[model samples]
Target chain A: MAKKRILIAKPGLDGHDRGAKYVARALKDAGYEVIYTGIRQTPEAIVSTAIQEDVDFIGLSLLSGAHNELFPRVVELLDNKGAEDIIVFGGGVIPIDDFDYLKSKGVKAIFTPGAQIKDIIDFIELQN
Target chain B: MSLNEIIAKKFSSWEKNVLEKLLKKFPERQKEFLTASSEKVERLYLPFENEQEKYIRDLGFPGEFPFTRGIQPTMFRGRLWTMRQYAGFGTAEESNQRYKFLLSQGQTGLSIAFDLPTQIGYDSDHPMSEGEVGKVGVAIDSLKDMEILFDGIPLDKVSTSMTINAPASVLLAMYIAVGEKQGVPREKLQGTIQNDILKEYVARGTYIFPPEPSMRLITNIFEYCSGELKNFNTISISGYHIREAGSTAVQEVAFTLSNGIEYVKAAVNAGLDVDSFAGRLSFFFNAHNDLFEEVAKFRAARRIWAKIMRDKFSAKNEKSLLLRFHTQTGGSTLTAQQPDNNIVRVAIQTLAAVLGGTQSLHTNSRDEALALPTEDSVRIALRTQQIVGYESGVTNTVDPLGGSYFVESLTDSIESEAQTYISKIESLGGMISAIEKGFIQKEIQDSAYKYQKDIESNERIVVGVNKFSVEEKPPKGLLRVDPKLRDLQIKKTTEVKKNRNNEKVKKNLSALKVASSDPNANLMPFIVDAVKEYATLGEICSVLRETFGEYKENIVL
Candidate 1:
């Protein structure tokens, strides 16, 4: 099977792209094609990239501790654009209960720290 | 058959049979690289090197004056370092759920990661916030979201660490309010707000106002937290972001310490006593893959900080000199390929943090390189900490890596190299001047480029990436965020705005603007007043920006 194309974008005031870069590397290593949008990206830029790239997944990495207001916005945009199947996911510091909430909100899997990559890979497989 | 011939024959036989036999397989053996990762190995030490090395001079006992070996003598024997894995993702409600889950899982502390919108003081409903709300962390615009973010989670029980810089005072104020509603007294609250705004100019980029006002805001937090929230750490002068920004281990130490020094100067200038709030000062550092180098960096950091507080600042209290820090494993080191390899990496990094004597730790999830860690992943990460703490016997001794000739030498060298950097920054008129001239920024860029070049050139091998190619395809089915979060959050934010007391928000916002314009004002009190009145984060930050001004980074890279 062909590897899924995933775009890892760092949007808004977050300039820390290290997490996204590592995620892109992991995805690519997992045989997925990864596109990295460098730091200071606006939300519009991320959605446009996700749409234009026709990626199978969009992974956002937030170290800025601002996910409560950031992650849902991306998902909402994805839905409004009629691209809900894009398999968007993200990684960061989050409490476990929030993971269930996000998963319920259509976040397929919420990975806190020490997440199993195989589990993530498996998750994407089922989605694809 | 003479005696000489007999001895020669025996020696020749021994050489051929034993040494030559092993040498025969030399061609098949892998070559060993002699050089260490971060610093040159100190081959031989002279007595002169230890000339000034006294128990009081070089190595102080834990919790004693000029603490270097450990922050406290008992260390984990007294109480284990807090296991604080920072977390937040998606809307306030979403992240709030995560916080509660983590708390249930025996996570002793809560460190909140703010999303972009909230970090730079934008409400989730703002145009700039857009699809970025809660993408990387929890988003909080007003008291509504803050209240929701902490919903059901007893703030009185858990210590919260907010990793917000430009808007730290605001987030902290919100947290205080959350505690207030939770029936927790302000005096009883314990937590840290990473109010080290100087680092925003140096490393992390979540800053909103310019440097001068930013410094003033930091001093304001110091003054307020000093008296109001005595248990709360006013600033966590951090090196985590510096290392995350791709600086070398030494640079992380140097820049972070220098930033700490600058904060102290600011606090002192504001007429605050060093000892009154010094014990509450905390630090955050990164534990990278370079085990020995990281260990040395921590030791060096403690010693250097002790001296700074004692000699430089003339601090009398020992707690004012000791550096208590929180260590988070470097996300930069985790590889996407051979994802399981990240487990080993995290293990090593966590071990290093433990060895370095961290007061608290947050281990990065292995699958984080793929997505936000799932429950399974977070548990694994927490397990990683538990295994290290319980199973690993490394913590039995304080600074287990200490006393080695090599480690001591490396610590000395790191200290000297860091001092050189401090001097260089000193030459340029301190960190702010260096920041203004883009000196530190340029150095990080150069180092990052060099490291990248080394990787590209195959000089630095990242296993399973540049090397050890696997033929089999990676396993499929990764975690993914849903498509509906955006609309839900937007609707929630819109509803909040529509239903909230806008007139009250306007009144509080104007008060915030007035307070922000005054140099002597403590922004945290006004931020608390604003949050209590439901003023959005954007409204608060906008006033600061308008009054102080926005700074465009002088990007050199």
Candidate 2:
């Protein structure tokens, strides 16, 4: 079986890379071929890169409070390409109340603050 | 989700396979098992039993009493919190353009993020800077970058904050020179340099000299800034990066405050008045998720600082007692999956900063999880703060949730818990010793490991991660820094070196090394002279590296 390929991209003004970096490391440890698209990525660029790289999943991490706008655009771009069937997920400081709204919009899942990496691994495995 | 429901969802299968089998096979004797947080409570907060000890003497009022509610009584009501979104990247001119854009968008202040080379005191043209130059943040090589960084903005009018550590003194000198270029007086210059190298080593992995010399450099800036830059904060003792390193709210608070205490001692032992430098001592904290935990953490921080100032340092002024800080929403909380979800996350974090009573706040852009924030995304980030300042009615009352049974109760619990950490660290020695011996690092690592273990063992369920799984993948939006930024930065830096007087640069750099090598020597004066002569950041840092050896990482991990 081919190893699952995932892309973890940090898309905003937040330069704090430890969290995304650690998650990528955790994913790699869990036997996934994880690619880290380093700091400051554009939505169009991330989508094209994801397609070109043939990723099975994309992990979007933002600690900056702009998740509401950026999250939707990324999701919409994938739908425009008719490639929305791939597994996509998100994690960050998403509030509990926003979960249902995000889910209704087709966001796979969200890992809020204090989310455990092992939980993320399990979620990814289950989803795949 | 209810505690039991959450625990059942996360642990039911594991319990059935292992614990249930064990219980069925050996039902003879029931052993009492107690853990940190059993199935009964997801988070085991301090009981009301210890409320008196935690609050009565420690947490007081918003601006008075113990001032735990907040340092300012009015908070956002007195005046809206300063919306200072952090920005920097590419060549100096590009960063300058971005800064202008941000300022125009109602950014009350500026926070500059320097590239890696600059953070470690290297010029853009240095071999080490390489393709990495201007990749993460604005590349600063000489006084030219600083000049371009602040070209049109009058330094005296707008407060600027630089996020540079190891080479902070040199950077500060550049800033001071920039102020001069703008025809601003030394006394009129405002803003801050994140000169807190101690935390850099422990959390951010950026440090230049060994502890003793690094402390000396910081103290030199503290002493110099006290006399010259009256209104400027010399160092922003930061918990921002520490929290980003996977520490719990309690761990972040304890470790950051301990570092603050160390700096205070350093300033005092240097014979500087606690009041002069202490008043200018500001903080930077990470506004992560866990609304109540973060809010409680801020309250506990203010209370802790007030006591440390009045009781420990014999500070007489209220200014010294006040702990003014800048908060940035937690960057560590962002994910690369389902990128659009980050906007909601950032808004919530920004709200936490406002409610926590920060003096200045930087709302991280959603695109941050993918790359640097573009104009549109950064505008939205700034808008998040504006909406909270104008629309949200939480600021109407001082410490809006101050009297809440839950919030007040949480504040006391967090304070007491942090004290335990402080005592534990003190017993092992001081903050420096703790960091050096990896006690502080180990605590953070243990907490991170435990948190990870919880998620892996199905003891915790992250919303989109472990519980609610989506079938279809969402598209991603990632920022891409122009690859040519590195080349442009290097060319500009090299051009500046060639244009500047080489002999003067050499003379000033040598003088800087000689002055810094002496144990009693203060480096601020030489650094000021060096920047004035247009010496590159690389020149100044290389000299310091030669004079005082570079710090070696001792962390086993």
Candidate 3:
């Protein structure tokens, strides 16, 4: 199978990109092609980029506590664009309390701080 | 025999007789021990023969030139560090209550945390600020919010530190206006504005203008503060965000001091005397998990900065050479799992900061990794500092670990390594050009990746994360900002606009635009004029963004 392509993006004004860049680089090392959009990306820009890249997964990283609004908006935009198959995962300083709600809104998984890169790769592999 | 020969003979004999036998049966846990920065650590540190000369040159007494031991003569024996917790969130009124609570709880100073909208220079109602108003910190749209944020607090009595960049001038102007309202003169106000913008390009991403204009704004503050606000620190050259962005301890010191050098050079080139402003140039650093490494990083930082001031800039005033800094426990080190474990981690980091001679300190709350800390968690964090300050007995003496062989060696190692990185940056034509070329960002990212890989492979053990794992119920009662906060903040800003005089606002803003265009004109007075007219932060920053184009980041993977 061809390598799984992923779009790693930051969808808000919070510039804590340490986790996002780390995950993006880790996925690439695990034989996945990752396209990372730098900080301050809007949901529209992120959705358009994911569509342009034709990635298998869209990993949204937000540390600004705006994840509840921004994460769901990204998932909703993908649905409107008929790209719902593009798996949407979220990460960063996300509280576990919101995990179920995010999952209900179509974010397949939520990676909080202290999550290992291997666990992320395992999640992606299980999707296969 | 001389001291060198005598110690060398004794050390070799001890190593052969004791260490050799022990290592044969019980090998060390790993092939080599390394610090958090991946620097090699030897089995033991022994004093060398040239100690007397080296001590006099490098480890002089506290409060002297090359302030390696500490900056003040008496150190904590004279005064304990200011226990300033960085706290702010929700609307100005809500945050004001939190500040009063903290002050009543014995916090010595105030460190305001601005929300994302205020940090990036957007009003609460901007499209870009959707879902972000008053989320991470307090949202301030105009002078009205500033007044409420410090409503009962006296400006002259309590020192304030604002973690703001990009729109720092606007915020500083608002602070001045607030002081004026409180019947305090600008010269009487004490505190710092985090006006360092180079780090924003390198690590934190809150930058507004390109490099040339940003440097100009920083110098503008230095020049303005030198005569106008004498008690205020013009800029806080920070390595905290850089370290949080995943650079090692060495990079933290190196890049931060390099940025400091850039700012000093900019001030001098802008025709401001170094002595006038360099004394007020404060520093902010991160206190990470490694006790010795973190301690040595601080010591090394002071020595390096002292040398830079004396040798590089030819600064004559002793105060200009002192590296007074505030430290905060590392946010990146806190683990979301086993939240209670973070208290212990913060306790250790607090000791390191105190031992490192920090002028002030902020301890991270245990629940920060999960959410904004609750009042309970914030109290515990503050108490952690108090316990160490009063009970730990580490503050009884100055630079208690100054002469330890291991600590001195590590301090030396860190300083030399940091100097090497500084030289490389200098070769790359200073910090701004190096940042423009993405050199600093690339270095930090590489270190961050390596650190993550170490955690993944279990080479590094983050207790409760990789090892000693536990399964527990999800956390409860983490502070949550109401989603309706955005609406309330927008309403507040709308009301402020309605009540303020519109004609004066436009006139001051236009004058600011013209002042911003002139290279020699200081923009501080112009900013203050606009701020006094109740012009919003977003409005002031918009004018600057129009005059000086926004910075496009160099995306380096």
Q: Pick the candidate with the highest lDDT.
A: 3
Q: What is the TM-score of chain B alone in each candidate?
A: 0.91, 0.89, 0.99
Identify the candidate with maximal TM-score: 3
User: Which residue runs of candidate 1 sit more than 4 Å off their true CA positions?
Assistant: A1-11, A17-128, B1-37, B42-56, B472-477
Q: Candidate 1 residues B256-292, lDDT tens each? A: 9999888888789888898887888899999988787
Estimate how well candidate 3 is docked, as a DockQ score.
0.84
- Winner on DockQ between 1 and 2 is 1
Question: Which candidate tops DockQ?
Answer: 3
| Cα deviation of B399, candidate 2, in Å | 0.4
Candidate 3 chain B — worst ten consecutive residues by lDDT sum?
B43-52
Off-target runs (Cα >4 Å) in candidate 3 are none
**DockQ of all predictions against the true structure, Cα-based:** 0.16, 0.05, 0.84
- Fnat of every candidate, listed in order: 0.29, 0.04, 0.74
Q: Model 3 scores what on Cα lDDT?
A: 0.94
* Model 2: residues with Cα > 4 Å off, grouped in runs: A1-128, B1-59, B469-477
What tens-digit string does per-residue lDDT give for candidate 1 at A1-128? 76678888766566775445555655676688888886666656788899999998888776544465567777888898998888878876554445666766666666644444565678788884
* Chain A TM-scores, candidates in order: 0.86, 0.93, 0.98
Q: What's model 1's overall lDDT? A: 0.78
